[model samples]
Target: MKKKLSLTSKIFIGILLGALFGIALKWLPSGTLKDSILLGGIIKIMGTGFINAIKMLVVPLVFVSLVCGASSMGDVKKLGRIGIKTMCFYLVTTAIAITLALGIGKLINPGLGLDMSSIVTTETVIAENKSLVDIILGIIPSNPIQAMASGEMLQIIAFALLVGVSISILGKKAEPVKILFESLNEVCMKMVGIIMLVAPYGVFALIANTFATVGFDAIWSLIKYMFAVLLALGIQGFIVYSGMVKSLSGLKLKPFLKKFANVAGVTFSTSSSSAALPLTIESMEELGVHNSVASFTLPLGATINMDGTAIMQGVACIFIAQIYGIDLGITQFLTIILTATLASVGTAGVPGVGMITLSMVLTSVGLPLEGIGLIMGVDRLLDMTRTTVNVMGDCACTLVVSKSEGELDLDMYYSKEENNIAKNA
Candidate 1:
């Protein structure tokens, strides 16, 4: 009879072992660890494959869940209102994050007095030169089958919203279809659970591959800029998120932090809210948040909500500007905030998207795109941190919305300590 450890404990062990394993490969003797088996490849392919599998589920899960949530509203206008409120919350918070990041970053001047003479320009990332027409038109796909095949999230979102609205209009006639969708949702959720079972192996490989290929010595050159990005993330995750959670709901900070530790660890290692969705949802449910709120807000948060990533863009812009000895005016600062927020909406929650969106943000405000190469190598680790904040923000938003809608189970929330008692009884 082995002891049953908590999810938190298990993940903590995985992270510890992953880090030590990674360090050993980097610092110690290579032997077989670096030879025949190729530890890094296993980590790279498995970790990335795990992420892709989860993302493959994202479109279907989100589409069905949104349709279910919206159909229940029974009022298109009310549905519109909720949509507005949710998007506005995400967009506003994102803009504020960028603003704070730029302000703090510039004040600190993280890139000042830098010598860029040795900076070798790597492969440059370019943003899709999307016109307003292209962006709007791209929202509704002509072929949803192709959209799903291609994993186009925006098209999937649009298609699902339409289906959900249509189902709501069908009234009693839609009951059978609704029942089928709900069942489909349940089956899909079970699949999410199965995917997470191998998470330890996947996560280990991903981290190991990342650290092995791009060792810390590679990032030693840009340590100041990296810390600047981290400082901004810390401020946003702790100060901003804490304030928002407290102000929006009467819940205290202590429990939120305690519950989020596991979720944060998963996000940091996985570098993806989409990948961490299952754990995040479970954590919120365990904390007594309603399924309706979690399902509605968390998926949306994974897509268009990227406060930490936006902060990275802000700091990067400043650093690049200083590195090139260019001064930014007040108008330009506002422009960066607006552009970063917009870029995040289109930024895919995947590895390459950050650099692409950062390129977009830089171009919008006339910043040099060349500076992107400087940070390309280290973006993976920073992505890990940013994704953790993304998941954290999602959970907090769910709590706030739940509390406001009177959907939260306060008794269950405060009874977190009663898990053992309930289990025993």
Candidate 2:
């Protein structure tokens, strides 16, 4: 019998072939064949459909999974502890990510000797700053229905968590509601499995379209800046994440990688952590993380855990400062870290959120907001990569919390054979 390709293997093939196909389009004569038929006709349809499909699942998946997670937590005190630990892990890692990015950016000096005189910049009007108190106050939804409609992740998270806790408090009185959420969670997971069947094609379409449309010139121009951001992401993913898994959970890194590849691929293709939450939760559960932990932590992590984005902001800040010949002091560096960290939480679920938060960080430290144009061309590719890391951070946190809570299934976690069985089943 011919062997079946693992989802990971299939996704890797998709990425490779997609890049090749895109580059091939660039080599073709610039005419209707390249511009109109391939890009405008086929690629747009497939890519848009795939993205819309993934996004369609986000709100429902987050709400159902989180509600199930919170309701399952019979011990409310432990729920509080889990919340604290998850937030701490996410924030600390984000701080570490930025610090690492700055060090890498400075050592690489991506902006030094780079010609920016030809690059055009437009003056941007920075939004009036809001107080920290106002930002915190805004998390509570004035209307839960509006929050859900708008996909306001932070507000949705807060609301879902509250509803879950209420059900738990009501106990037997809320049994019907609890059962309904549990059923809905299963339905959502089923939808995830169905949606993922289209992922390889979706991935192929998205990547090919991006490369074909954007071309390589934009990427090559900012190669150094891209390298620094990618390197920092690599360090965070392999070194930081690997060390956390080994020390915190005592799980072998090999199995984790084996499980995470498909999730990473989806995150890379979609460039949206919220869209990737369902797969992240699925992979975590298959890796023996209890549903409660996976559901609760992954949803929250998708909302606020942005280590990869933070790294990009850090590198971009340094790169822009060097280009403009601006010197940053210790106080300014501290401010960048603090601002980026807080901004990650505040800016959750916003489109083009990375650049928005980067703008905030820049404005905080007296950096020119117009400098954003320097990195804009390459942000799409970097966004895809950073989002993969963001989802990975969420899964890592899930594992860590499961370990502390004694929710990890050691047998399932260790048995590679079970992976095949689960998939086959």
Q: Can you give the lDDT of residue 353 in candidate 2?
A: 38
lDDT of 1 at 368: 56
* Residue 47, model 2, lDDT: 60
**lDDT score for candidate 1 against the true structure:** 0.69
Estimated TM-score per prediction? 0.59, 0.59
Compared with the true structure, model 2 gives a TM-score of 0.59
Residue-level lDDT of model 2, residues 278-318, one tens digit each, is 88888999889999888889987877688998999999988
Score each candidate by Cα lDDT: 0.69, 0.74
Question: Which window of 10 residues has the lowest lDDT sum in candidate 2?
Answer: 117-126
Root-mean-square deviation (CA) per prediction: 10.6, 10.9
